[model samples]
Target: MSIQLVFLGTGSGKPTPQRNVSSMALFRDGELFLFDCGESTQIQMAKSVLRPGALKAIFLTHFHGDHVNGLPGLVGSQTLNQRHEALDIVGPRGLKRWLKCLRELNILWPGFQVRSHEVTEPGIVFEHPEFHIESVALKHRIETWGYALVERDRPGRFDLEGARALGVPHGPMYGRLQRGEAVTLEDGRTVLPQDVLGPPRAGLKIVYCTDTSPCAGAIELARNADVLVHEATYPGGDERLAHERGHSTAADAARCALEAGAKKLVLTHISQKYVRPDIFLEHARAIFPNTVIAQDFFELEVKRRDD
Candidate 1:
């Protein structure tokens, strides 16, 4: 019923003394989903209530060192920590080979399951009973991708008042009506759920993008997201630098959020040049006022507010 985002690290490739690279953990219900396991990610997860072994899946945007440095360690730690379930890792092509090489050189953690999936096109990457993931190609120096997590819509609450008005007493019958089923009363009268149940509500959507410039695919993948976590490696002042490096600025990220109709924007992958993040946030807020600068150890809770 709640979506929680924990910021493990927010700095870009060149790490500063205080900030590590990009890493984040998303928790919805009881499952934990990870995005970009940069260096020190294991340590970061240790700081939170998230158990590293409980990570249901990991989605890597690219093979950039900063984005994937902690993968081997994370996998290795699962074995060390004694995990029982398999870990699903979904990313761009060559992911399997990369992990294979790492395992050949180092030890392959034996206890947990680690499945590697290489995505070549845009579509669903991973799916479970509760959630699903999809991605789109991003514009970058290397082959990179972004992801969107779509949760399945849950059933709506039952209309207890409507049921009462229909002469349905409060008991086990109410539970059956809540499940969208008809209940037979002791009086031999049938009560339909449609008269007592409200319409099903839509679920929340979370999208993430890293190490990319402005691209149309990125916008489409992030459409109508409750939270869009996009990279703002630089502020808006340096368009040339951003273009040269195939990176996005704060303004670029903000525009993407506005274009995608995202309700909130999380600006991350911060450049080390700026000590104070307010400058980056200020530029982004100029366009997308809902923008917030991602900070280490910061946690954002996603929930719907009454209109």
Candidate 2:
């Protein structure tokens, strides 16, 4: 299955003429996961290919206005649209309290179930059949979390010639073998999956870290990630300001990517001070050659290493 990333809003603190606040959409197979629903996030979704009804979960990094101000409006809109699928909202501590307040204020009266998951500590927060999500505390002024979506390792390709040589008839038994299950033949012969399958293939890992300064947690979460989406709220020369403000410079983001051995680095959460992203790209590419500056509505398809 293919995984796609859509940058809904990439501006920091506030929206700019060219960029919105902080929001990103991750489309895995058919399900959609949103990160940081900043103000006007729904508007950005409307303009992009994302469907509100397809959203499975919203993973927030913090409670900053630029990171979570659009939650109520988005949930309310889902109610208006009559969505029935349960939506999971995962974030740092205080998320459940904030959701409770929204419910009391009638700001989010969703017809579907709204599951809120507050992360008191860093560990696996959400799990699915094919993948799981892990969270880690980041260095920020407020309580914040970085997330990593890791897919489960898949079985290796089935060797049809090997199966045929083993006298294994092709049918349901082929599927069973491909799924790493042993199958019993009508002749009382037992065939293990390893008999006709290659070595297990590695899975994909995507990490998202933002609204934070350079921290060990970020590097740990991003280790060997296929793609690392990190915040670059300042230019290379503004490291002092970026650190003081609990944000990261382009160089800082690149260094984290390099340290984590990330295959690709995408710099987002751009400050409004820079009208252009040339400097940010230049700074990041200096340290991490496989770095790109994210823009509003920027879309990227993360392919497997084998592909």
User: What is each predicted model's overall lDDT from 0 to 1?
Assistant: 0.87, 0.93
Writing each residue's lDDT as its tens digit, candidate 2 over 215-305 gives 9999999999999999999979889988998999999999999999999999999989898899999999999999999999999999876
Model 2, residue 185: what's the lDDT? 87
TM-score of each: 0.93, 0.97
- Residue-wise lDDT of candidate 1 within 131-190, one digit each (tens)? 789999999999999999998776676777788889998788888887778888889989
Best by lDDT: 2
Which candidate achieves the best TM-score against the true structure?
Answer: 2
The RMSD (Cα, Å) of candidate 1 is 2.0
Instruction: Give Cα distance to truth, residue 269, candidate 1, Å.
Output: 0.2
Query: How far does residue 82 in candidate 1 sit from its true spot (Å)?
Result: 0.9
Model 2 spans with C-alpha error above 4 angstroms? none
